[model samples]
Target: MNFEYSDRSKALQEKLTAFMQEHIYPLERAYDDFVHANEWQVFPELERLKQLAKDAGLWNLFLPEEYGEFSEGLTNLEYAPLAAIMGKVYWASQVFNCSAPDTGNMEVLAKYGTPEQQDKWLKPLMNGEIRSGFMMTEPEVASSDATNIATSIVRDGDEYVINGRKWWTTGAMNPNTKVFIVMGKTDPNAARHVQQSMIIVPADAEGLKILRPLRVFGTHESPEGHAEIELDNVRVPASNLLVGEGAGFKIAQGRLGPGRIHHCMRLIGAAERALEMMCKRVTQRSTFGKDLSQYSSIRQEIAKSRCEIEQARLLTLAAADKIDRFGIKEAKDLIAMIKIVVPQMACTVVDRAIQIHGGLGVCQDTPLAMFWIYGRSIRIADGPDEVHMYQLGRNTIKSFN
Candidate 1:
């Protein structure tokens, strides 16, 4: 495989790296301070950074021409490194309108929405005029199996009435989140995977209530908020239904391929940052008349971290390449393999960084603990590692047979 990055990708990567250093990295502390000070509102500085990124033509790097509405239209392989750079700073992706839930939502609308639907939401979403959330996982079901979701979207004349309780609906708590792409059972009697449908529900509709934000690891409140909300007889135009009455599963499969790749790339960035911090800490601190780096165990940890990061990076790029070359369905095994590997890799790398720093690493003074939490969350978020591992293992066994 030709693993080398193209000139176009390299140029964009350099530009993105420079933007992160000059704009994003410097704002890390300030971003934390802003979040702490105004825990309820969106960070004003992030919006400003978004404008800067847009003006520089660095927006929506994840959406390729296959979608037709993406600005720069970079392929998954081309976008991987730039996304890796953004992953280094958790909040950086939003500046370029490349962050999650919205990215997945946009991909769905672009691929499935009717002309009128695109005009209403897709255009504004591409411009980053508003934010959105996906509501598929329900509080009452084993959500990893989408077929188990209990939400119902029943037709009522010109509109569909939706009812269900959903948690971990990431981004729903943000006031800026104007829409929700909800998944529910439209025809429970239909075949297992075909029973569900996705519909656009306006955030302001009556009977819709965003209850509270669920904390990740008892600390961080995802700015958009991993939220619990009630959609009690919420109503939307029947025209809001995407693709058809039983297309939610299909839409999810299409959206999640790119979404998983984005997550894996971001995890690599996080792991790289943790390794940087670990090395800096180990070398700068002296203990027992020598730098911590001189300790054999610490040196080994650093070396091992480097090896792990390189391996995970290569695997993530391979997954991206597979998605670009073959459709997501065709690359399911690789996608599952990377999904299982990257987050676990990041968690290990960040945990080591924390250990090297002693107390400071686990404290707010350093981002290591937060990085660790983000990595750990992904282990359960989206889906669990056990689930991916099971699928990957089964695929491997089948291939051998």
Candidate 2:
């Protein structure tokens, strides 16, 4: 397949590159400091950057033509490289209103929301006026198998009351997160796939409580905090359900296909940045009066990293192309393949980059450690590698049958 960027994409790429250089890259340390000083609250600078991004016309690059009322209306193929640029600076995506949980949640609303639902949630989200979260993982279940989720959403009178605990609800810790697209079983007696449903719950509803923030790799908070939450009989009108009762699994299948590709694109970007840093570091510093870049091992790593990144980028683009040509369901194998490949590639590249930098790589002085964390986190975030591999294998075998 031809993966060439169109003139429109190229021009947008130029603008995005300039924007990152002029505004985002310079604020890396400032963003860190602001986050560290705040007591689990969003940094004020985020809003300021959001306004700048909105003014500069870089907002909502993830929204598709069908779903976007106030966005660039770019498809997954068009949006991949732009997302790659944002991945270089971890916080940059939020500035453009294209970050995760929000992106996934927005897509769900756009694809499945009623017109009224779109007006209430999608409009404010697209405008960057409100934030959202997705609560599906449970603290007790091996959440990799979403069917194992035990959260319950039961209808009572005209409303549904949700009861369960969710961890790794990524954006829930943010005080500004105004709503949650929560997944829970609405019909335990229905068929396995049809037992669940997705409901939009107001984050401030009486029974919704943010119990505490969950840490990753011993780090208590990553600038964007992941959280554990207790939804104790949270009530929302029956009209808040996305598709319909017993449609949760269907919605998740559709939502995760796009989300996985976005993660792959961003991971490829992270690997690209890590490789750039590796080459720069090894060339500038000499070990025992010889250039580090001159070493055969370093040269091998550099060559290998180049190949790996290119392969991962191609795989991601192919997945995007498949999604565009066929429906997301038809593109499942391509999506799963890239989801398994991209994160591992980024982690390996970042690890080598870290080795090249000596101790400095693991330190906060450079982004290698953070990049590594992001890639490593992906192994667990969107269903672990093993789970996706299992599905891919089963799908492959099914085709032969």
The clash count for each model shown is: 0, 0
How does each model score on lDDT?
0.88, 0.87
RMSD of 1: 1.1
Q: For this target, which candidate reaches the highest TM-score against the unseen true structure?
A: 1
lDDT of 1 at 247: 93
Give the TM-score comparing model 2 with the true structure, all chains together. 0.97
Compared with the true structure, what per-residue lDDT tens digits does model 2 show for residues 212-329?
Answer: 8877876655555888999998989999998899999899998898888878888888899999998888889998989998899999999999999999999899999888778788
